[model samples]
Target: MNQLPQEYYQRLEEIQAIDFVLVELTLYLDTHPDDYQAIQQFNQYAQYSQQLKQAFETKFGPLQQYGNSFSDAKWSWGTTPWPWQI
Candidate 1:
């Protein structure tokens, strides 16, 4: 398998960062539900992460899950591409 492109790896990193923030905020918010800043940060990170996911999927393939037809019109799940340099 080939390694992922620089752009793909960079976006993945960003997605991971946002996910981390979202998880942390959710944990904190469970105890401090009244924390507006944390809530806002969570929302912001979530949206950013989704946007990145959509962009990556649009160009590459499904980031997760199956049956998505954004990249290929055929059976995308079985044909899921590997993230590596060819």
Candidate 2:
């Protein structure tokens, strides 16, 4: 397989960062459910994370297995190196 570009790693990192924020917000909101600002932030991050994942999947193949992601003519999941494998 060809070497993955720098942008691939950058985008993955962005997704990871957003996911981290979402997890933290989830924990915080669990205790302080009345914090409207935290709830809003969590929703925003969740949406953004989905968008990022979609774009990444479109360019680099599925980020998940099973029916969670779509496949083209060929299954790229097993063909390409996984995110951590790179």
Candidate 3:
């Protein structure tokens, strides 16, 4: 597989980091459902992650085979290179 561009990797890293935070917050919330602060933090992270994902997809293509990421004129599923190929 070929290496993806630096920006792509950077965005992926950011997404991963944000996802980690979300997961951790989710676990905490599960145990302490009344923690409004944690819930707010989780929502913020979720929104940020969504924005990052949309940006990534807009530039680099869909991360998965499904979802609303395919908003382009042409079907990009088979055209764009996969993350592993990059």
Give lDDT tens digits, candidate 3, residues 1-86: 45568998899889989989999999999999999999999999999999998899899877766565655787677666755554
Write model 2 residue lDDT over 1-86, tens digit each, in one string: 78889998899999999999999999999999999999999999999999999999899888888898889788777776776688
Give all TM-scores, in the order shown: 0.76, 0.89, 0.83
Local error of candidate 3 at residue 4 (angstroms): 2.3
Query: Candidate 3 has what TM-score?
Result: 0.83
Between 2 and 3, whose lDDT is larger?
Answer: 2
Local distance difference test, candidate 2: 0.90
**Residue ranges of candidate 3 with Cα displaced over 4 Å:** 78-86
User: Which one wins on TM-score?
Assistant: 2
Best by lDDT: 2
Query: Candidate 2, after superposition: displacement of residue 38 in Å?
Result: 0.7
**lDDT, model 1, position 80:** 42
Alpha-carbon lDDT, every model:
0.74, 0.90, 0.84
Q: Every model's Cα RMSD, please? A: 3.4, 1.3, 2.0
lDDT of 1: 0.74
Error of model 2, residue 3, in angstroms: 1.8
Clashes of 3: 3
Candidate 3 Cα deviation (angstroms), residue 65:
3.1
